[model samples]
Target: MNKQKIAVLGPGSWGTALSQVLNDNGHEVRIWGNVPEQIDEINQFHTNKRYFKDIVLDPAIKAYKELSEALDGVDAVLLVVPTKVMRLVAKQVAETLDHKVVVMHASKGLEPESHKRLSTVLEEEIPAALRSEVVVVSGPSHAEETIIRDLTLISAASKDMETAQYVQTLFSNHYFRLYTNNDVIGVETAGALKNIIAVGAGALHGLGYGDNAKAAIIARGLTEITRLGVEMGANPLTYSGLSGVGDLIVTGTSVHSRNWRAGDQLGRGEKLEDIERNMGMVIEGISTTKVAYELAQELGVYMPITQAIYSVIYQGASIEEAIKHIMSSEFRQENEWS
Candidate 1:
């Protein structure tokens, strides 16, 4: 594989982890973040203590406080920032970009205001002259595990197959494997919507529900995700792939998931503000639940699980009541469309 110079924005857990992956692949990785102290630590000590407490990053991985310095002459750019700041960061990158680069995002979210996918957000913010077709890199992999060089499989998806394969080559390595897919919509939809189910699953565990309930949440939550994804023009089969069910399994079950952790805190009677404040990171599902709830309503899709989570986060509904609301809803055929 040819060594490429890559710019990674965010410098958070996911961004730091991916930069390490690129460094491992013998690529020149330049990381950009807003925090001066974090950038200093990474550049001076080769560690981002705020995210990885024990791990020391490769000395070759450089961190820059200035966005332009990071983007200077990079072949590709990876965006791993929070969805909330995706547009702002993309716009900044657009302004700094001098040549065409393949843009990829690892964030899993919909814009709450526009209810649009992050890829769409990038497409709108970055001019076509500055970037190729946007690619979505998503799946079951978490930054904590991935940073440790754990065996992980993820999708590199885009409407353009060549571009997807191009990204597939850019990041794939021995431990970090990338599979190419042409279903951009399905891949992105699954990546973002799974966080909602993860929150609900975490809430189920916090509520003292047993495996049966969590299993039900995973299974039924997938149905809700698939239903909404389909309504949003995603292929049904794509939901069964890594970006869909695979992502849902990891996020909904793992303690490493911020969305799940947030839901768990809520189930334990913690306030949303307190949970957000304590995590010190973005729990995307909280906002995603609201966006999914609104999208389901607008698309006339039935998503009780999303509504339950939304009720808990936005409407101040009790966990027990939310679960009760879901359980008490009228039953439908196992395969209604069939």
Candidate 2:
């Protein structure tokens, strides 16, 4: 195992929160943010005012405006930027990165138009010649809860076990737990598709659907995610773990969730463009649902919940119509796929 200097590459809620955890763990940390004012606040006040105001940042943490400075001499890096900018940001880090330091990411969701999982994009974007050190940290981690030092658990996955363990230590705190897994594909795939389900579940909640429907959505949503993930060569059990089921439960129902907020608007008959533009946060569910809908088509999988979400958002299907469609569908034994 290597003692590594880590850089968290984004300064959004997730990025800032990850940096705070690492700083608390006594690792030398630096971060690069595109926003000049955000960087200034982090440096001078030792706090992230944009997303996390209640938690005080450790004074020892550092910030760099330049990509070179952020990636310089770091043994590992966490790519915490949005899914859309992942490739562009990864390329910048790959150019200056030292081979000894591994790369870990905390971002989730696939590129909708490209239909690529985040890890696939990372593999393609990062300089292939830099050597294999890519891993992902995901699960039921929310930036708001993490900033308050809540007990959060995440699954760290890699093709390499040592790298995964290294990541486990980088962000793990007394209040935060990290678990290791070698199923990188499983972890990333589940992480992406599960967001789509969360959005659907949120839509159900917003429509005043009862707990019966919520529980059904949660279970059936896992089934859809698992089916797709398994088709992509992921472990079936990964969906049952924290990064899969745990994430779905949190992002599905939490008021702090941007994805759920978007889903609620859709349930309330708000336009997708308006919801997206007005929310201002990265409502990953919007993008993830579209990608998952296409993926289900490509894979010939029956993902009814995902399809219903796609219908409501893109096909101009009404909330009541989607609900009726789901309820009116054909019936089957519960253990058919189990």
Candidate 3:
């Protein structure tokens, strides 16, 4: 593979982890962040102490405070920012972009109010003239393990096969692997919706529920996710892939997941505002829950798991009450694909 200069926007854990991967692949990585202290730390100490305390980053992974300077002469742009700021950052990238580049986003969430996927948001902000197909790189990978060079595999999904294959080649290494898929809609939907189930799983754990409850959440949550995904014209088989069931299992079961952590706090009777304040990172699942709830209602899709989590998060309903409601509801045959 030819060495390329790539710009990575957002210096958060995921962004920093991916930058390390690109650097490992012998590519010139320019990481852009808004925080001056983070930029200085990456430059001076070769570490992002805020996110990864002990791991040292490569010296070749240069950090930049200026957006334009980072985007300068880059071959591809990997967006790892929060879903809330995706539009703003993509717009800024569009305005600063002087040439076309392969644009990919690792964000997982639907746009609030618009109810559009992150790729749709990216497409709206970044013009077709300024970029290639909007690729969504998502799956069960977590940044904490990824930074330590643990084995991780994820999907590189796009409508364009060449672009997806290019991204797969760009990020693949001994420790990290990428599988290319053409189901952009399924990948994005599964990636985003799984977070909500993860929140529910974490909440169940916090409530002292055992493995049985959590397992039920995972299985039923996938059903709800696939239901909505299919309603939105996604391939049903995609739900069984890395970005769907794989992501659901990892995020819902692991303590490393931000959405799960937030849900755990919620289960312990903590306020959403307090949890957000303490986490100091964007919990994409919180907003994703709202969007999924609204979208399910709009589409007339039956999403009991999403609805239960939504009630707890939005309606201020008690977690126990929500679970009770779910358990006591009318019995139905399993494996109903509707």
Cα TM-score per model? 0.98, 0.95, 0.99
lDDT score of model 2?
Answer: 0.83
What would the per-residue lDDT of candidate 3 be over residues 1-338, giving only the tens digit for each residue?
99999999999999999999999999999999999999999999999988999999999999999999999999999999988889999989999999999999998898888999899998998999999998999999899999999999999999999999999999999999999999999999999999999999999988888999999999999998999999998999999999999999999999999999998888888998999999988999989999999999999999998999999888988999999999999998888766
Better of 2 and 3 by TM-score: 3
Residue 118 miss distance in model 3 (angstroms) = 1.1
Decreasing lDDT order of the candidates: 3, 1, 2
> lDDT of each structure?
0.91, 0.83, 0.94
Ranking under TM-score, best-scoring first?
Answer: 3, 1, 2
Model 1 worst lDDT window (10 residues): 329-338
User: Per-residue lDDT tens digits of candidate 2, residues 119-172?
Assistant: 788888777666456888999978899888899998999988987887887777
- Please write out the lDDT profile of model 1 over residues 1-338, one tens digit for every residue: 68899999989899899899889989999999999999999989999888899999989999998988888989999999988899999999998999999899999999988999999999999999999999999999899999999999999999888888988888888999999988888999999999999999998887788899889999988888999998888999989989999999999999999988988888888888999999999989988999999999899998888998888888878989987887787878877631
Q: RMSD in Å for candidate 1, one decimal?
A: 1.0
- Minimum summed lDDT over a 10-residue window in model 3 is located at 329-338
